[model samples]
Target chain A: MDERAALDLVGGLVGRAGDDAAVVDGTVVTTDMLHESTDFPAGTTRYTAGWRAVGASLSDVAAMGAEATAAVAVYGAPAFDAADLEAFLSGARDVCERVDAEYVGGDLDGHDEFTVASTALGETDDPVTRAGATADDVVCVTGGLGRSAAALRAFDAGDVDRANDLFQFTPRVAAGRALAPYATAMMDSSDGLARSLHQLAAASDCTIDVDEAAVPAVDAVADYATDDADAREMTVFFGEDFELVCTLPDDEIATARDACPVELTVVGDVTGDTAAASSDGAVTVGGDALPDRGFTHGD
Target chain B: MDERAALDLVGGLVGRAGDDAAVVDGTVVTTDMLHESTDFPAGTTRYTAGWRAVGASLSDVAAMGAEATAAVAVYGAPAFDAADLEAFLSGARDVCERVDAEYVGGDLDGHDEFTVASTALGETDDPVTRAGATADDVVCVTGGLGRSAAALRAFDAGDVDRANDLFQFTPRVAAGRALAPYATAMMDSSDGLARSLHQLAAASDCTIDVDEAAVPAVDAVADYATDDADAREMTVFFGEDFELVCTLPDDEIATARDACPVELTVVGDVTGDTAAASSDGAVTVGGDALPDRGFTHGD
Candidate 1:
């Protein structure tokens, strides 16, 4: 099956398996992939690469309005050295400490290639799922988007110095917590802004209209995007953004923004339909006419 | 790194990561691998196979002397059909239910080939470790050994019917619980009896002597062995036997056996040396001359 069908089947099984944190009561666990399709370097040994994987996984739990409690990582290594494994573990430990999430036990096995699987567990009074948004809700982002993608481009072009800071981007944990009480729907934008917006809209059974001009883009991407079209495309379709995209009541958005003080952007509004289109009329978030350029398994 | 070094490093990391069931402070947890190396089909599957991948993992936690609490499964699937994925999940779910373990959230990704990684958590009052055996401790087993290995051989030889029941051997949870209060040092023997005895001796810093007559073998295996010598070889070297090899004070061994009447065997005694030799002057258990012949990764 394709990604959509596979996801549907998995979602059904997961639902039956138990509710969120169903396996262990009083805990909510979430998982996300930092894969070659989205994250770069193709292996586990790049500088701060392991941290990115742990951070991306933790970000998923944080987006659900939970404080990360523990993490279980399964790494696939093919002909990897002891030093490389130590580096990966060290980086993961650092991230775990930073988030106050303990590094729980996990497994290591050999494979034909290398991949990192990180699962983060957290605790919360009530998790903020993706299906709580309502019509007339204001959509907001916790931090800037398109920077990680821009960093990838910079790294690929040997501009590592310019992308160094962006490469180690931190997940917006504080912002997620601050908005959790106010936001009705929450999810991390690992699969890019447009696709994530479409996901949030579909999950909440609401339409979202993005004010394209209001969405943030990295300055480096603007320099590379020779025209506005390229810049818009990069900002919309580029993956590994790791920004918190939330929908809240219009009144609560202002209060939430004031309390969090991150780069909260009111880039859209939730409507009553299942559509996610751009207000500028130039870009469409989930239009059939647009290409399916988001990250996919085996892509 | 080689398997020994890898195990050492991983053991150290796990030690530092936290103790068993440390995630839930009040609970105790244990873990084991039902690795593809020993428990899988001779041929590859579109997806990974065997309930043991899930069963053995949960059994470790169960033998920890704990109840199956939660589990996180990491699956590596080849580029294959969705039906295979569903089948793998179904098998894993079946084991989870059998052990009363809930299927917690985990990671799933595509790989160059298929593999399965399962981590199970259990709850106990005081956790059991491999280093708790004392000198003059009597060793015992939960069930018969050499059956799984014999089953594998039979299956390989195209006698599936002969091995079917043996292949689906259930973990001795009731027996383990009955024996836990008395077991000084304990571990499930996934490796061969000889290797597991060696491991227990190394961990407890003691010698273990096994009586050849005490070691159990299948009737078919005895018939196939022609004599005691062949049966002894198969019993010593054969792997994937998930029997609990445990040690208890000699006086307490009878109590343990009486608590669970399951043909408890007086396989050996724990001594203050680093050697483990069998009785009947046949094979030494932890002799330095023997080459390690159990299942190994990347073999």
Candidate 2:
């Protein structure tokens, strides 16, 4: 099968394959996505590279409303030296500890090219699944969207400082935990807000309608989007924001935000229909009678 | 640096920096080695392929004197179909249940070649470590060695049934647990009997000496050796024997054997000075002069 088909098949299997952490009784660990097709630039900040890996793995656990408890990292690094390897491990450990997780023992090997993989075990008493959203639930974001996208634009324009702040992001573990009890459906916005919402919508068997004006944008993104609507569009479509997006009952929105203490903005509401459309008629979650545009492996 | 130097440096750093799960005051989950460099055939045995992957991982926890609790598998398969992927997962889940470990979660991706990695966790009060051996300790093995090596040879020679029995081997978890308290030092012989003894000896700051005659050898391996000396040599040098070789106080040998109820053999004894040597007159263990002949990645 092609990459997309393989992803769908694997995703479906894992989704149905019980919980992520079976030993913890209430915990579940799911393999959200794994593709060897994304391009990570060489000479990128090593710290950021390490953070990217940890964040990627942790985000999956967070998406399930589970707090990461431990992680096992397996990487295939060719000709890597002691210092580089140490830095990589340190980075992973730092992230794990920051998120209140342990960096467990792992395997290492030499490969022709660099390949990093991790299995994160998480624990939770109540798991907020993507299939639990209901009509009239408020779709909320844990933090600002499109900043990472804007950072990428700045990076492409050689704005290193601006890009570093945005690209080197952390997962919203604390925010996810705070919202887990109240949120009906939860997921991390890795494949941009639009695509993630589309997934949440599909999984919940409902539609999501986002208010363009309500979707929070960073100041830097607004600056970058000045006179470039396409760039803004790309920011909404291509950005991996590394933030939690959850749908909760409209009544619980205030309480959830108060408990979370995060800058959560109500970007949309869940609908009974299976469509995901934007209010301004210029954007779509899954797309307007077309397919959603998100990060595709091997694209 | 050479592979040995690299390994030493990396291993030392990992040992120091990585959390000493074995040393920590908690249940330790360990798994055995599944090296593409040694263990399984390079081709064929699709069903056994996943088993080899999951089995190797689960074996570590099994050898740790702890019951298998949970596992996370990371694999790289090149252009594998959904069916193949499902079969692989099914095989992994089968082994997980066999070991009483839960298949918690994992990661998967495509690569230039097929690679399988797994991390298993288990719980026990305190883990058996390799640094507990002492001088005057009797060296013993839980099960027969050279079976895996024999299986490899048979598979290569198209002896399917014989190879299957040998290659698809089960670990001595019961024996490991039974001998945990009696064992002065313990480690699974993944990198051959000679090398594993050397590791245990070095870790425990003692010396190990194996009698060439007492070291067990499979019939096929014995026949392949052409003579007793050759058989002994193969038993010493050939790797991928996942048997538990432990050193215990001389007085506990009888009790350990009775408790384990396996084909326990007292191969040798630990000494204050270097004495372990192979049938070929080369010092294989204990002596500082012995050459490192165990498996090395990228060799």
TM-score of each: 0.83, 0.84
Which tens-of-lDDT digit does each residue in A97-170 have in candidate 1? 87777776555555545556666766678778777888889888877777776776677777766665576667
Q: Pick by TM-score: which candidate is best?
A: 2
Q: Write the per-residue lDDT of candidate 2 for residues A175-233, one digit (tens) a residue.
A: 88888889998888776777777777777778776776677776777767756565557
Quote the positional error of residue B177 for candidate 1 in Å: 4.2
Candidate 2: stretches off by over 4 Å: A7-39, A146-165, A217-229, A232-235, A239-241, A273-290, A296-299, B2-40, B159-165, B223-234, B273-290
User: For model 1, how does the per-residue alpha-carbon lDDT over B1-299 read when each residue is reduced to its tens digit?
Assistant: 85546656756765533222233453443333333443565542323354556666665664566666666665555453567767667666766776666665455556544556666666667666677877788887776777766776666776766665566556556666777789887777766777777677667777666666778776667645646776776676676666778889998877888996466787776755554443422124443333345644433
State candidate 1's DockQ.
0.33
Chain A alone, TM-score per model: 0.85, 0.85
